[model samples]
Target: MSPVLPPALRGLPVAPVISHPVGQQTTVQPTTACELPQQSATGWLKEDSIASGVLIVLVLTGVQRLIGFVRSLLFCRWLEPDQLGQWDVAWGFLMLAAPLTVLSLPGTFGRYLEHYRAAGQLRVFLCRTAVVCLGLALVASGILLVMPEAFSWLIFGSGAQQQLIGPLAGTLLAVIAYNYLISLLTSLRTMRLVAVLETVNSAGFALAGGLLIYCWQRSAASAIVAYGSASLLCVVAATGWMQAIWQQAPQICPAIPQREFWAKLLPFAGWIMLVNLLTNLFMIADRYLVAQFAPGDSEARLALVGQYHSARVLPLLLASLASMLAAMILPHLSRDWEAGSRQQVSRRMNLGLKLLGLSLTAASAVLLLVAPLLFGLAFAGKYQQGLDILPWTLLSGVWFGAAALAQMYLWCAERAAKACLATALGLAVSVVLNLLLLPRMGLQGVVLAAA
Candidate 1:
């Protein structure tokens, strides 16, 4: 017999009890629309809806790149080629070690942040990620500490440059912490702040380096010191921002199973770290090889590295669009993917590729025409030939940018292993081509292989 309903309940239709497969009663839940919480987007691109945050990142990154261009142009004018060469190694060493510092956790961290937040494990997620990354950082730092001078000689050349060992050791440790914190901020969608931090670092380095060079009578040590100072500032600012956000974030759950947490995050982290590391190796391989193959003493080979680095800069700048878009869209893509918004993902990915192609092609033409003339005017003598190499090197950047986009998609799709495999295959191809071509083609061959 049916139970008697209260007067208030009599007007409503009763929900029918349904039998479950396990022989238990079950009830269906009525549907309601999901409301998304408001979040900050990239400053200038906020109006662009789904793509805004990334567009803003690209714009700010472009501004920062321009500042970097100014710094490079000024330094090249102020210093001799060999001096520039030595400084390049010093400056680039920090960037080259980025894979170690970051371990590609930014990508993986963002992925899991969305998952854990949905599962009501936000606090636990942050803690586990932080602890794991911190441990990895400590281990990497210890490796660097064990024979700093050997690193100095290997990277900067000669035992006399041992002065770099001390500062570089500290920079490595500081940057590792910075990378982890910044990754957390990114996962939280604090993109505007990230852009600001990047800008501060870029603009700060330019101004600081200029002062150091002018005030100290122009020395490589001044440039290195300036870079380290800027990096430290970036780290401090990122820390402050990360702390502010973490403190305010809603904790959905107080605890997560440690064994299960690590089990999920580690596999993805390990694979991505390899992907980022190998990609880094592929990017910088040309420099070392160019140095090795270029005739002359250590100084002369180093100068060639400088030339290659400079020639490659502007052309590669064109690819920043792709990177900005990739970073900006990653969190969104990860969420949409989890929510089963397959159609949305497909549309955006297709549009991004079209935009990349149209913009890059036009920019490539402009670069091809303008680069030689501009380099000739700014840097007299051999630099005019930099454009000859510029076109090929530019191709590499554009290609790399495209691959980066595909990789981001793969990452968000939870295909970390597949992503690593793809990158490894490309790295292998690059390595083989570089070996075969550099012997006969010289610098041209190196970049062609890269392209």
Candidate 2:
């Protein structure tokens, strides 16, 4: 017989439950009001399909790279070889320094943010790390402002371009903020937003920097200013959006203790910071060697660096793509690892490495085939030396991209220290090779060493 329903419950419809055989398990789908908030929160942080995520990143990255390539062509056309070389050195320094300044705290987001989110401490983690990153950036910027000449010598291989120090310092702060937002969004599996932000930054830089370079100053300083302005604007826009999202989010979970929080995060972040330093240093060491040790006057050496830069433009694009893939892949791998799907993580990583290797090799071949035409048409054949070494640069870039993909496994396993050691060894070898070869074979030797 049916039980008599209370007056308050009589008007509501009931959900039917079916009885099962002995030892059969029944699954209950929760439809209570209290469960709705939890479901919403889960959906907010749920991982996107890997296919969709990669597709979004690839499409947007391709667009961004196209704009960036055009910008590069314009810069190459407008600036003299030495002037272009100055910009390259300054730009590389900024890339290396921004990550270093913040001690790579943003890098931790991919591996740990999900863990924190599951524990209801995502906001706390984000806020604390952001404050620390900002403080470090401010301190680093202060140092740069106070000692521009010293850093100028450090970056340009001389103190004459000290004027750039001020611009670089300001830009570093903006870049730190920009990187933080990008990293945070990426870890949350918000690839579309990350791609959009990057596209905006690319478009802004190309439009503003091109105008400034062509119409106004026609110097590295102008490009620096434009970059900083775009980055700052992106940060401002992203922060506002994030604030609105956070306000609507349910925040009912108890916070994890500070001691436990730092205990897990700092070790991973420390190794990542070291690895980042070594990796950036490895990337730019060849250029620095050419700037400081190449057998020529400053003008001639810079001209050679400019030529090298042209050769590397396309090759570096491979590395950039690899980095994006690795960043996107890490979050998924971390989630799987956390869920104790360790073998599955390994299989996915293996498949990724193989695919990345093949794709990069094929791309390198195509780039090789088109090199001469690109040099003649786009570069106006001015960078003949760069054209000469295009094959070596392409090969180097392919290897580097593969290496970037390979390191994702290390990162996922919390063996970042091992990755750091490997990169440090590579950097040490690179330094020795550059030292030996730069004096002997000039730009070609440096290119070979990098390979």
Candidate 3:
């Protein structure tokens, strides 16, 4: 019925069908031609689950921070300047020591544990991390227990006013265990549990500290004992939670050999631990330096250190929010960067930096207005003298928090060496400034050095 068409124009030819015998099936899957999971419009923050996780962590952390602020306020109301100063210095030492006690497992554990969990090796990862932390904590606590006085000297030097070595060493051990358990739960994504741990810690501190002030002596030892008892209870609870998290972990597939797994963790964690220790040092170093270099008698210098610590509380409270955000974002940023999304990294950076600016600015302004009135009201007028130092200290915390956030990007990108070097550089500057300015300006000089 139709005219005969040329063979080439008749229809588009289909490719010849290819088939294989039963014995000729391909053995290896071709990964090169496949799209990566995190690409193709999928990403860390792009997922609903991840976004929700971050939000929940931030909210819970904010609640915990509020509780902590209340506890600190109560502590201020009860303790005098010299006592508070001694306590602050001791607490600073604990901060430096606590990270070391765990060998800096928390930050590094989250990254690897997340990967291991996805790979169905969570039990092995959790078991190994717990063992490592426990071993180190035991060793560290033994050393502290054997020579609490020597440890006290290392932290506060000679002529220390409140030499509560026994309680300090005991609290150190309890905190090390508590923190490790908390980190384990965080890696398990039991953020609510972590929040509860902090909530309980803060609430317990308030109840215990208030009780001690009301019934017992209002001294550094009493405060330490109160907090220590709270820490012990928390340690027990966290242990049970840790065990629960372990039970829920799927152990269907075997994990890698322990040596091979630890080899991967140690290199990453070693560098991070150094960075964390240095960062913590820089934070409380100013107070320690002021205590060391203030041009006055021991009692007077200690009082100044105490006042500076009081001023410092406001900034540290604001920094808690930033810390929560950074903690939540670290995993997301790591995933995004590893997925080759430089644009996402840049966006996160800008957003976080902006929030840091707004939060620090607003917090500083609010504190500037209320610092004098609140300090006088709550801290018995002893802290009003340091109102001038509060704003600058708060601003410096903004700087510190900003730097810490930047360092998180480095850690997620596996540039912990650079982060360590950067903190080392800051620590150097801090040392130089503290030495040069502290003698001339007293506590104000310490604030200047910190800034």
Candidate 4:
């Protein structure tokens, strides 16, 4: 017998239900157009929209890169080759040391933060990680403070620049903090905000670093001071914004056991840390080889690094874009994987790789065509060696960028150790090549090894 329906209900048609086999999940199909899910006009703004996120990152990153290019040009114009070289090595050390100090713990944010958020444990997860990151950063800074001469030799290929070590350590602290905030915002799917912050950082660095370089000290130490100041300001602004967002969110106690959380998080983070360490080393190994073994005095080696830095200016932008894209895509991939949509994840990744490769190849070609003009006009023919090796550096950047995008799949599948291993092997090859080629062909050999 059919149940009697209310007068209000009687006017509406019912959705028919179909039976399924035992233990099978049943889904009812919508009977009317109005019953189906409809996407709102603002759906593109949603956190889950990968296309929108990518577009936002690309536009803002492009702007940031432009500003950074101008800043680099100004830096090259104002400082002598040795000073520029000093700045380059200092910058590389900051990049490599910050992630190492933090154990790449923040790298897990994209993959795991959403999982914890859904389980009402984001607060706990963030608190624990932040504490760990801070402790590690402080310890690293302290080590730098105590052993400045040792680090000076390791970083600068000479122990004479001990004064720079203190500033570098301070700047590293700021960088670590800034990177943590940026990673957190990215994992929160606030691509627009992250882009804005990045733009601000670049602009601030330009203004401050430029003034200090041109008007004040005309040295790398002053540039380091400017960088640290800008990073600190960004950190403060991001923290306030993040706090407001956090307060608005519902606070719920975590249900996951502490032991279980650590069990899952550490292993993944450890692999990511290894991967980051290896990747950083791989990227800068050439510079280190040139610094330490280029058959020159400290000043001469630094001058060579300055030239290398000039050649790298444009190529590294592509690598930066690749990193931004990879970071933006990882969360989407993780969500798809979490939803048991493995094939969908693969499809999206493959599509991204294809598009990125095509776009990068085109951009590289364009840059190559313009290389001579840029070297002649913008550089004032000051860096002839860099100009000569631009092609090799461009090729290296393109390939490295592609590799970074390719590793996203491994990251999504929790196979970061595999990525680490692959990068390790590549770094080994890079070292061997640098050793074999650097002595024979000079800076060109180093660029070729990187390529």
Candidate 5:
């Protein structure tokens, strides 16, 4: 008699009522457990991948240094002061040709191909890029042919002798191709392969150049030829290695080459190309300036060039290490940025800066301490002038390390415009300084120009 209910309602099952601790009735509501997204595992995996890449790059750096040191010893023992200076000039010309020729698109191709390969579209991208690189190489070579005198005049002036031209052009062609392959391997994150190629190429050059100097009693021109031959061999070897991988299964596609492949990277490529050009100017302008101003002063310039080259050895080695590290981290940063992973980006960036600083600092200290003795031991005794510029040139090394970090950030941020503008501005400044300084200061001026 407690409560009365309708007949139809009484047939329906009653909902369960639960009593709370507060003495209130409550209805039970079944709740499913909430699942939050987990990124820690993926983040850790990404970090491990980056660390692995860094380690590989460091190992490669060590390999490069060992090879380079050996080559330096050979150069010191075999070549005369004047010949080494001429050799430096020849390399300068080759560097100039590099940027104007496809604006270093081969490198861009490598970078882009790496990305596409990571995305599982390597064949399509690689095919397209290959065409572009080949075509561009041809076009660049053609342009050089027409304007041969232009660069020669700028670098060597009217005195650029006929004998050097062939060697120079040949060296440039091989260097351009070799650069592309090395860059491509780096992009693929195959540091060991890159290191192997570099080691092989360095050994080839060292042996060939040494032979030319020792056996043939050759001039600087012969050294140029040796370098060219070595570069060609390295390019061939790298290509063969790459092709071997394709032998398992091969497919054919449209002949769209680098032109099509580069389309995706036009924005960054443009700036990067310009930046590279400027960089070349900074590195090579000193040699060119010395050649231009000190045309009749070959003896003095030769000694100076030999020394500057020696002092630069350690810096270049460290720069390679920095560059390799930067290359590997770029992809990781790009990925993190795309995924809206701010924390990861910050962490990666910090790590990059630390690594760069540490490497550069250690390298600079060693270079500063041992450079004079090393220079004395490695080259003709005349190369002592390079010691004069070591401290300042070390600055360039640190700058490059920092710049590499900045560049990676720009790449990740997609700030190509800013990057290009900054690089262009820096290049312009360096060029202006080179013209102003080198004529007055000689090799010291060249060092200043480099800085």
Candidate 6:
């Protein structure tokens, strides 16, 4: 006597089945496509976890910047401007070489590693990435060793920088390898460990630099030795720690494919290479240009440029934290999008913006307010004359942080081409501006270009 079931319910016919008999209830049931796992305190979908993660990332980023600031101040007090300038020029060239060595692939490693982790294949991901990094490092090192003079003359002219060629080339491979390995752990979502490694590296560099200067006679060789050795040590410590954590708390399954990992990593690595090269080129080219075009006291001009550029460091550190937060949330965003969680994704985007905005605004304000005082303290009043760079540079932090966030979004969205385009444009603008402005404004021109 029960009414006929509608088409929508015809498959299960729950009403009719229930009306038939109580005993029949056990005989039939509606089919469910899937079941959700039990939610936990840190469930994947929760906003609270996202907020906490953002807060933690930002705080750690602040810590990293503070460490850098203190270290720079100490270095300035201990070393003369000309001495620091020489080190800076050598270091700038070294920074330029770094991206080339890795083919810039490690920059995007975190994104792919996130995908692998989400797919439950972590160990295979790490091993494969390591192989790619090592191979690239060795190749880059060999090339640098072969073409040492070409690099030396290009960055440091035919003068004293030629002397740095051996030391620079010798440690170049290890530095690149160490960086790639440290970055691998970061991709695995061990952010705390990543921050710790950076802190240790920074602290170690400062301590080593101090020891070399005051205790060991202000040798740039000693400073470089300490810096490279500390980087290698941190990489080793972090790698071992990551392996131990993996063993203790296995998070994902081994999913390395039968095909070699190098093949899979090459295309992505190439993209990373272009992105990093263009980005680093934009960052360091101005100093090189200053060294090239400044009419008198190239060292003084370079040091002035260094002072202005250093002002941006604190903001960059904070922005990096924002980038880290974005990176952490990206895999979750990708997973949610796949799972059709549109609402959750929107919420995450809004929350990420809000948190990042507040943190950046506050930091920028403090830097702007104390820029003169801080610059004076850090540079020992020698470069305090260029304090005007602080305000423009601090304001530029907003753009830097936003740009970084945008890059992260692009990276997660697999819009590397668009990210590259944006960066290329920014770099072009910077280069053109510097070329036009540096002769007129000298160090201030470089600051304008950087801004």
lDDT of each: 0.63, 0.75, 0.67, 0.75, 0.61, 0.59
Error of 5 at 261 (Å): 7.5
Question: Please, what are the lDDT tens digits per residue for candidate 5 over residues 276-371?
Answer: 555555556656666666535646656566666766776776676676667667768867886889789989898878877887888799778877
Off by over 4 Å in 3: 1-48, 114-129, 159-163, 246-258, 325-359, 404-414
Q: What TM-score, to 2 decimals, does candidate 6 have?
A: 0.70
Model 1 stretches astray by more than 4 angstroms: 1-52, 90-92, 101-107, 114-146, 156-160, 217-220, 238-243, 249-258, 292-294, 325-359, 380-385, 401-418
Tell me how candidate 1 scores on lDDT: 0.63
Over 4 Å off, model 5:
1-57, 103-105, 111-151, 158-160, 180-192, 238-272, 294-303, 325-363
Please tell me which predicted candidate would have the highest TM-score against the true structure.
2
* Per-residue lDDT of candidate 1, residues 1-451 (tens digit): 0111111101111111111122243332311221332234343212243365566677787899799888987776666666676677765566657545655554465556656655445556777666766776677667667877777667755566676666666666666565665565555666676677778888988998889887884766777778778878888765645555455445434455778777776666665555456555655666766555555667776776667767776755666556656665677776777688988887888887777767777788788887766777665554544567888877776776676666667656656557556656777787788778877876788778778
Q: Candidate 4 lDDT, tens digit per residue, 211-279?
A: 998788989898899989888989997776766555544364535587898887776566556555666
- As a whole number from 0 to 100, the lDDT of residue 332 in candidate 4 is 84
Q: Provide the lDDT at 204 for model 4.
A: 95
Model 2, position 78, has a per-residue lDDT of 73
TM per prediction = 0.73, 0.79, 0.78, 0.79, 0.71, 0.70
Better of 1 and 5 by TM-score: 1
- Give the winner by TM-score: 1 or 3: 3
Q: After superposition, how far is residue 173 of candidate 4 from its true place, in Å?
A: 1.1
**Distance (Å) between predicted and true CA of 6, model 2?**
60
Candidate 1 vs candidate 5, lDDT winner: 1
**Residue pairs with clashing backbones, model 4:** none
* Candidate 6 lDDT tens digits, 219-266: 445556666777777777765565553443334444455565556656
